[model samples]
Target: MSLSLVLLFLNFFTPQFNEAGQAKLEKMVKDRDALTAQWKASESQKSGIFGNRTKKDMIETNEWLERIIKKDNLIMDELRMIGDIETITATQTGDDYKAIAFKQEKDVQALKRAVAERDKQLKEKLSERRTFEWISLILFLISLGLGFVVYKKVIKP
Candidate 1:
């Protein structure tokens, strides 16, 4: 039953894990697209006297690159965690299978012992019944012989 529950949990959790990873990836893609659009818009702007706009764009670009790197690292870490979870689950499931197999073997042995005991009891009962039947037959034959002898002596005299 614990094994079944574990299987059920895995069935539910794996899809959720996949969905979370996919959502993160989608968010990253959206961020990248937004950054690209901003870069393009800034490129189309004219150079002012101070050129302050160009400097601001460079700073924003640098920040975007850093954010992208952080997100990638986060995603890689999540992937590694998922891999570790899979390894643990596999090991646990294998242990559960072995336990179930061992339990079944024990149950089988117990059933065989029960069947052997029942057969022995049945044979003993049959032997007792046969003995009773033989005794009854011998008693009946003795009585019949005695009756015949008494009838012949009294009737003939």
Candidate 2:
């Protein structure tokens, strides 16, 4: 019965582990890596600015800063996405637990109901047995009394 219940529970509420989001995470990682490489290349180009810092060099540096800021934003977005996924997974797990708990509660209630019915039946049977015993005792006493009266009346006279 327990095994059947477990199987029924599993069959009813199978968890869906989402692997599709993994591909998106991998793509985000690649994008971050590519951005890091671009930032590093931009840093290496700073050697030209150090020799004769011109407006062009400053503008180039500004562009590099912008790229870095863009990368940071992308990283932040990725982190948010990961956070969202974690929250979703946690919520799903919590919901599953609640469902299991509810099912268990239902099972307990059903068992309680069955036990109450059985107890009621047992009490009824006991009452019936007691009634029959009393009837039997009364009949026996009446028969004994009648035999005694017959013996007294017949044998004495």
User: Residue 136 in candidate 2 has what lDDT?
Assistant: 100
Instruction: Please report the TM-score between candidate 1 and the true structure.
Output: 0.57
Best by TM-score: 2
Q: Estimate, for each residue in 44-140, the C-alpha lDDT of model 1 and write its tens digit.
A: 5545566545666667666666766776677677677767777776777788789889999999999999999999999999999999999999988
Worst-scoring 10-residue span by lDDT in model 1: 44-53
Query: What's the CA RMSD for each of the models?
Result: 5.8, 5.0
Task: Please write out the lDDT profile of model 2 over residues 3-98, one tens digit for every residue.
Answer: 457555554544322244556656766876776676666555544545755566567767877876786787677668767866775776677778
**Worst ten-residue run, lDDT, model 2?**
11-20
- What TM-score do all the candidates reach, one by one? 0.57, 0.71
What number of clashing residue pairs does each candidate have, in the order they appear? 0, 0
Which regions of candidate 1 are displaced past 4 Å?
A: 1-3, 18-78
